[model samples]
Target chain A: MKNKGLLLVVSAPSGCGKGTILGEILKDDSFYYSISATTRAPREGEQDGVNYHFITKEEFEQRIAQGGMLEYAQYCGNYYGTPKKEVEQMRDAGRDVILEIEVEGAMKVRALCPDAVFLFIAPPSVEELRRRLNKRGTEAAEVIEERVSQAARELSYADRYDYIIVNGELEKAIQDFRTVVRAEKLRTKNGNKIDEVLNHA
Target chain B: MKNKGLLLVVSAPSGCGKGTILGEILKDDSFYYSISATTRAPREGEQDGVNYHFITKEEFEQRIAQGGMLEYAQYCGNYYGTPKKEVEQMRDAGRDVILEIEVEGAMKVRALCPDAVFLFIAPPSVEELRRRLNKRGTEAAEVIEERVSQAARELSYADRYDYIIVNGELEKAIQDFRTVVRAEKLRTKNGNKIDEVLNHA
Candidate 1:
């Protein structure tokens, strides 16, 4: 296979700072973090096409039917899917793309893009996760409990991941993530580049 | 399942530096690198139980019959196998042990130690591997040709490994090997040390 950019699929429970990591990776010169398409309504101050390619339900379904969606799913009655064109374009143009999704969506993307690297982000433990959720202080006690319980269940699927990052220390976690990205690039796909460097030297 | 040490099984073609990397790892102070017991006559300057545990053919067969050998194979009319008791003792003492064996022997060890990490080292390409083999200089041209042909057949089994490392660059390959070791240790054995590191912080 020719040397090309990578597709990084990241999944994490709610409040695990997947968004924050995504934002940081976008600032990296080596990556082009993708904006997904969603039928869900945008929150205040979110922009169309920038934050997400917001569209009507009919439009979303039409794109799916036309095979424009790489992976898509419905959650709480709202549809979300990754656009196939932009991600492929960025990779072909030599920029790796990041796809941050839920575990279910990550599995979907894995089926669609078998070469994509799968990463699972986890908190320290159920107790630490609950502490983080409680510290948010923006949700009701019942809602916090529900989210914590959901996180606990989701963690059971962590063994399925190629790499699991414990998101307790930001610096260390980011370093580990970057190491995985770099090391994966040196696999068979771009491994020749290193050889070329050595041969010329 | 307890926080016990792991048996790591690594295999590769002769020039892939499996021996060198395994030797570097033995210096970690927390690992016990397994020495094979063999029935082959020792070469000059070779030490018993250090270079190899030289034994008589009759003694080697006795160990195999008694199930004392973790993995054994006869190559060129000589017996070689890893001793089970020493490995178990090292692991029970919480010291990781590495077994650097050829592919055939690795398969046997995997059957005996199911939880062991099985890694295969590959060169960037068959052509590059041939060049390295030729550079060794001790081998006759016919022998080099035979080894290269053997390496080509071995490449087909690369997928049998849990992780594949292409030894195109020495330092990078070493780093990749270190990453696998560190990441494997992070796996939750019984106490989940990675989780504890996250939680306590």
Candidate 2:
């Protein structure tokens, strides 16, 4: 049966290796990873449209005002959001669109698209999460403690997502993610296609 | 995270290659293929408790009256049904159980165990179904035509299933069956395991 593509909302706490897992998943051409239009300045070697859809504060607020942003949040005095039109367009064209966002934004997207697949990547344990964060060596001990607390809060919301992949091993997590995509596509087919076989009779 | 095993309720119209697909699936030791109980006389080369639990009419009626049968159907003046106790025992032991029942029996299991995964196997087309039914060359033209009509009726119920696999290529259909099993196991995890991580803190 022919059906529209999936809208996938993915969330993971800061130190859960979500970026690496998602980066591996996006290598497939069938997925159109939703690029957030942000007011943040592009970092060195980051291309506009490829890394982030760089936009002015005026345009960011204007899109939010016009309801063109699917979900947006103000972080570090910068606006970041998924463009509503692009995500819908990609799905309409039978292309899966992945939205990588934090928990609050994911909840917002859930309300807007009830059928969207919600995926949460989780570390094996809170201690493991702290170890990963500390190993990064980019945060002070106090900052790491704060992040661990924030991560506990995020992990609390893991129950609400449709599927949770405990990232114990990288390869298994990637394979599990692909299994979800295949199973969801099979689940989401339009029932009206029962007519296809009946018509052939 | 610890969780109970899944009870998978599978239904497919005759000639849709359901037995072949399920035979491939049951090769994995993690699954306990459900053997039904019947009052009918055993066919050639059939063994008790292997092919089915062949019981007397009195015993079958006793089980039904005691609510021991999960779902039962009367066919050709004999009784056939799924024995409820063994299925529950296997599932409680963390072993996935497969119930390969027909459409009506599948619905009864659905009402009894609402969380049981429902899978429907479908052919590529009704014409293909007719072709496969006729290919057996054992039935008469009238019987074959009746079977095709019966198949169409069963296909109408395919929409009620949680997932549908259109068996076009044999290998791909088997792979899809495995995919659904993996994805469903991922989906059916108990959320209370979030404490596993939080407790480490």
Q: What TM value does the first chain of each candidate achieve?
A: 0.89, 0.91
Candidate 2 TM-score, true structure as reference: 0.90
- DockQ values per model: 0.17, 0.42
The residue pairs found clashing in candidate 1 are none
Candidate 1 — which residues are off by over 4 angstroms?
A: A1-7, A85-96, A107-116, A133-146, A182-201, B1-6, B15-17, B66-68, B88-94, B107-115, B122-164, B186-201
Per-residue lDDT of candidate 2, residues B29-102 (tens digit): 88999999999999999999999999999999999999999999999999999999999899888788999999
- Model 1 over residues A102-164: C-alpha lDDT tens digits? 777887777777788877888866777778889989999999999988876777666666777
Question: In order of the candidates, what TM-score does chain B achieve?
Answer: 0.89, 0.92
